[model samples]
Target: MSVNTFNHRWASVILEALTRHGVRHICIAPGSRSTPLTLAAAANAKFICHTHFDERGLGHLALGLAKGSGERVAVIVTSGTAAANLYPAVIESGLTGERLIMLTADRPQEMIDCGANQAITQPGLFASHVTQSLNLPRPTPAIEARWLVSAVDNAVALQLQGTVHINCPFAEPLYGEWDNEEQAWSEALGDWWQESQPWLQQPQSRFSESQRDWNQWSQKRGVVVCGRLSAAEGQQVAQWAAILGWPLIADAQSQTGQPLAYADLWLGNPKAQAILQRSELVIQFGSHLTSKRLLQWQNACRPQEYWLIEDRPGRLDPAQHRGRRIATAVGEWLRQHPALPGKPWAQLLTELSSAAHTCIEQRLANEFGEAQVASRMSALLPPHGQLFLGNSLVVRLVDAFAQLPIGYPVFANRGASGIDGLISTAAGVERATCKPTLILLGDLSALYDLNSLALLRQSSAPVVILVVNNNGGQIFSLLPTPIAERERFYCMPQQVDFSHAAAMFGLHYRQPQDWASLYQQVTQAWQHGGVTLVELKVAETAGAEALRQLVQQVGAL
Candidate 1:
């Protein structure tokens, strides 16, 4: 009688299918069932594997990678609670329309009834939060190979809408050696092309709307406010803005080119009072927007018509009806809106924009603190690298003064704005693509997810994190909470040195006390290195004043 031996052939097939689909990086949390997948991924020279102790951070890392690369990235973890750890990033991805693929490894269906260790009803765990969910069985080489390809294709497709999940169930014999790696890869690749029907072509539709002529609805005082968008998307929006003779008001994540008739798109929050009041029409696209003033304008001015162009409309603020949702792509809407003759609106908006930018530039020039650190770092970021701006003070300061050097891809979590797993997501971005990834975060955001730095050990792209350590949660001061109570609960300031944390995780770390030194160090770390941290200590009160001053200047404009 011949004895049947178990092998990791199934995992190799699954990993190969993902690699074939252009998934270059995978963030993994250690577990028995996930071992085969991780090992196979690690062995594949084309694929990078990032290891994280926390599954939550792993999920965010994958999201960050997806945002940076503009390609869907996956997260691998054990079943049961391990799969649940991906919830935070899943929610963020769903709300912001981020393309993140989550791969949770689980025990076979039979094991679920027996109460197996780390086993639960994994199906539908993230169904509500994700665009779609799928599960595949670990079968023999021939069957599993086909399933692997199908799973990868489905994951990529679902990512177009938002987040997607693929749960893999391994029966037994968890680990072994694969005798034929080529056979596994060929089978999966072949099956995917042959059997899996591609849904690549989403037929473009002509935009139909009531107001074909934007001039009919509003005159020379028009404003273009862009949210988070890809480079291609930004260009499309910019072209549209040019045709309409509207001045652009862009967020750092908006991707809209600078000097859009307006000297700076991000003049400290697009929703600021001054900008919104000056504009008669406000057309918004993508997401990553956190402007209280915009919401206030929507309620107060109640413009004749506030048009929202989105692939999926009626999602942005349910309470307000000041804007009617136009179910069409921004590019399509812009193409249909008749071109404007003069640059009157553009000129007025530009003057205001230039004044605001001048004030911000002056403040940044005078200060060598955390507030200036963000703007300074923004000035230094590579023109084409991916930037993952962490939430809290970092994002606000970036919003105030940081202008994305032209041609860079910028991303952030503005849907729910939580500092839980930013670094993890950014690390995921670094691991998944060959491009340079920069994470500009405050000390609070860094401390919130310290486990993310540990995931850097397996990344292929160079990741440079600028940690603006203001000692505590400086953003808390701007809020309405009581100082002492807020300091303890909301701020929760901890004096954790990122240097020691990085060393503990076997990563690189640096402390730059001045602007020149920080700039030189950051430039070196970002240009050539694995994963490095540049920590800067600044005064919280002064940083807050700088941010407030930026806001005031934008309001004055």
Candidate 2:
């Protein structure tokens, strides 16, 4: 077979292995260097291929798809800065364990270290950000094809823990006639060539059950807190907490029916903290809790037994507390341990949390602002939709105040939480779930990902890009920075609007002046079935200031 044929065959084998490994989605950024992987993906009927102009946006798109579908998603990008642009998403995958298979095309070894253009070091580009890295040399008859398939299978094996970078360095003459004649030369393919399975099967990741007497732990007053999880995991864990009669503090990402949903705010109350702090055992169901106050309390109180249960194996504790870190699926763990109920603990926190939610309702009554829009999430959204929260003030608003609509899936770039590619990620979530999507973001975040609005235009389901036009990074105002450097350096206010951006993208645009009008606009947009940009122009400090006041009042409870 010709060299070009070998390259295509090599790329095809990798794609096929990824397919057998349960990757149904592949996000590709348009580039010449990545043509082999892109064409291989296009030729296959097993994958739904998505193409984007930006590698950064493409990585986030794959991330959202993987997080929504609970499967590994593939990404194909060219070498040089295109691969470098994926660093943010790579870091996020590392932190959150959303599996990404990045197939980056690079120049052959001959082109490197010789002042070659577009040949900056491709190996170890992602470094520690990815879980595994495979730098494949140019396809040659000297190297058996079976090694390529096995390499892919081993790297992608039953693992959903972060990205696996596969760098393909191809020589010139990349595009040419493809032939399977090379397959005949390999006696090594074994039965793999004829079968539709992976070259190898990987070991299942099992939880090392320190299975210490659960009977002893179950008797103690326990608190179950959940972070980012699949919709089903959230519902099941919520049921477990309910049956056990333990107080459940879940992040908005879980979208579980929370009892003390406003605990992020009400946890500020000394009375509430004192009641929860008396717990003999504090059992957290997941990692990456959004509530700083709750995490701080745990760090200070340091309960006799503070056990954390997460599917990902890592030291995920933000406080770095010495606790039992169990690695297992939430479902598997729930099934193994039956709920042994005792008198409910921290019941008083419910009343204080209710007060905080009530405070939010009263303040946002018949008004439209950043806080108002965020506080209305439970009502503004229906269960048939999903949420993609931006990294700035809006996410914190939802985390602190909003009680989610149960069973509605929520997506966010909480890992390496940067205000970039959010629009593309939300669009990917819409495509994956085939449900209405609501993207709540600050004006600055919208500005950062402004180009990604083009992605929304291609959505198959309804999408609402709710831009809280606070005109700057209002999240900065929450900090106690000196007044001299606050506005110009931190807030970096931008006097711009999204109406033209919506118009540019051929999307429906609405700037609501009141709360009722905003509600109608968003709900109606979903009903109309397309992308809509709803801009809420508010004061620079409204969201942060309101949140501070809400916490203060809730503390008085």
Which candidate wins on TM-score?
A: 2
Give the lDDT of residue 83 in candidate 1: 92
Q: How close is candidate 1 to the true structure, as a TM-score?
A: 0.81
Over the stretch 358-426, how does candidate 1's per-residue lDDT look in tens digits? Answer: 776786787788777666556667545788888887777666566565446777777779989988777
User: For candidate 2, which ten residues in a row score worst on lDDT?
Assistant: 184-193
Tell me, by lDDT, which candidate is best: 2
Clash numbers, per candidate: 6, 0
Model 2, total clashes = 0
Measured with C-alpha atoms, the lDDT of residue 379 in candidate 1 is: 62
User: Candidate 2: where is the Cα deviation over 4 Å?
Assistant: 179-194, 207-210
What are the runs in model 1 whose C-alpha is more than 4 Å off? 1-25, 35-53, 113-115, 135-159, 176-221, 257-280, 298-301, 312-314, 322-338, 346-349, 361-365, 457-462, 505-508, 526-531, 549-557
